[model samples]
Target: MSRLARLGLAVTLLFALAAPVRAQVKDDTPRNYGVGRVATPGQIAGWDIDVRPDGRGAPPGRGSVKDGEKVYLDKCAACHGEFGESAGRWPQLAQGKGTLASHDPVKTVGSYFPYLSSVFDYIRRSMPFGDAESLSNDELYAVTAYVLNLNDIVDDKFVLSKETWSRVKMPNQGGFFDDDREKTEKAFWNSNPCMKDCREPVKITGHAQAVDVTPDEKTQKRGVE
Candidate 1:
């Protein structure tokens, strides 16, 4: 089996073995460390981070859009712009409100995401590039609120907390539809595919006048291309 499959099997076996004693314990979820020992509470806390779409697993805390600006400038502005327009190759986090159907769509936290939990969860675990998981709960809340304010999803006075987190609606919340292709597209599978009569013969209609992706001949020799 693959590495992931093996690890999953190990976790399942461990959970089954330790479920009886730990079933009544309710502070946090149980975990297995793969070394024939149960993971400690501290270790479980580090990895037990995952916020759902309906805000079922959010932790208790609060932050405001006003307070979030400072956190954004200090920690996030170096990579993502002050207003969430990202630098050189970094990901943009704000704006892109109505460009989802445009030719050059800019997907940002405001325009593309469907869940507020995702915004909070991402920064909580994987933000600030080099310094990941360094922000405190309030700091993460503040930065998240600031990014939302940049996109106009929330006002400056709006406070983000576990209680009000799910109330903030994203523009694309209902943009995606549930997958029903298996039932609706049964005709496609019932009939045989027309390999010979699929479409007209392919033809090249355009060519690039000046473009080169291949490295220079000299650069190739040095293996630095």
Candidate 2:
């Protein structure tokens, strides 16, 4: 071979020989990052506040509906209103029963939520809006109980605890059902979906401007001016 051809072959051979060495170095590199230590049991417990539908993760506490009313008035009344009827644009928590079938369905704690555990979990984790997780265990139970009372799910004399949580039946509990689409729709499902030319060429059917949802340039300019 000529000198130029021989030099090119040598350069190629050099790279081919070094590839295995580079792979070996990468293989010998340590896998352990050695940055974060294993979290302590106490640390894990602090963050493990998620309550299951079966009431598995709920903490031990009890609060009477009467006591819950006081707690609700102090912490929740400003936003949810004194009787859970809502204040201004805030959500209405109680008395939305039989409204789900209406044109404008009122989806509240009583009318739509399926599980009582969900209410407890939400209030315990995040409630009182700006001041979240500030309620004590007793206060948390009380507030939740009071909300249940407002919804007429539980009586005024009822005390909410982990034991009594199962007894508190929400009105719309029967409205929800487990998703069985996997089993039910398996026969209808297409295993291999079409990737190309799935339908006819695109056509402009309509514009969003026709719906008047989007503000026109003139309206935006007027607001700015």
Candidate 3:
């Protein structure tokens, strides 16, 4: 081919490749969809509320179990029952004092939760369903005290405040342990194996049968099976 024609073909290919590069550079520009505004301190203070286990974020207030009982009856009894037994498919907040590892374990505030702060945090963040964060600090304290009283963990006259919050200990506090995978790894690696014929043959000894399989008189009268 001629030298000028070859040079023109090379220029055409270079422009075609550069067109995509230019289009990509244009598409990669920073986009701002009105979601990049900085938050003020007041805005942060309104939403940044979280309590720690060591009673770090407890608000300043107090409430006795007696006062909490009144609050529970007025505000919480409709869903949580008059005694925290749960209305329907809600949650039972009380009872289950010492039944953690049973076949039918009844896990409640008194039996399962390890920290009291979690209870307070949960109430503060979400409670009474539709009305969130409506309770005052003292009211939250009173409700927590009432729940503890209902769980049989504290006396009816016991007061719960920032000062006395950490004194209450749950029944299953010692049930949790830190993860020790290193020790577990050594134990698993050093164990002996029984790969050959380790399992024994099993036999079916008993079978389950329905006891109340009798049909009702109405079905018999209707000639329905």
Per-candidate TM equals: 0.70, 0.70, 0.65
Decide which is better by lDDT, 2 or 3: 2
Per-residue lDDT of candidate 3, residues 1-225 (tens digit):
899999999999999988755443456668876877899998987886688889888889999999998888988999888988889987788887657767878777887888888788999899767898999888999999999888888888899998897788766777789998888777667557777877888787755544566676877555467
Worst 10 residues of 2 by lDDT: 21-30
lDDT measured at residue 205 in model 1 versus the true structure, 0 to 100: 80
Candidate 1 local lDDT, residue 160: 87
> Please, what are the lDDT tens digits per residue for candidate 1 over residues 62-100?
888888899889988988988889998899988887888
Using TM-score as the measure, what is the rank order of every candidate, best first? 1, 2, 3
lDDT of 1: 0.84
User: What's the lDDT for all of these models?
Assistant: 0.84, 0.89, 0.84
The alpha-carbon lDDT assigned to residue 24 of candidate 3 equals 35
Q: Highest lDDT: give the candidate number.
A: 2
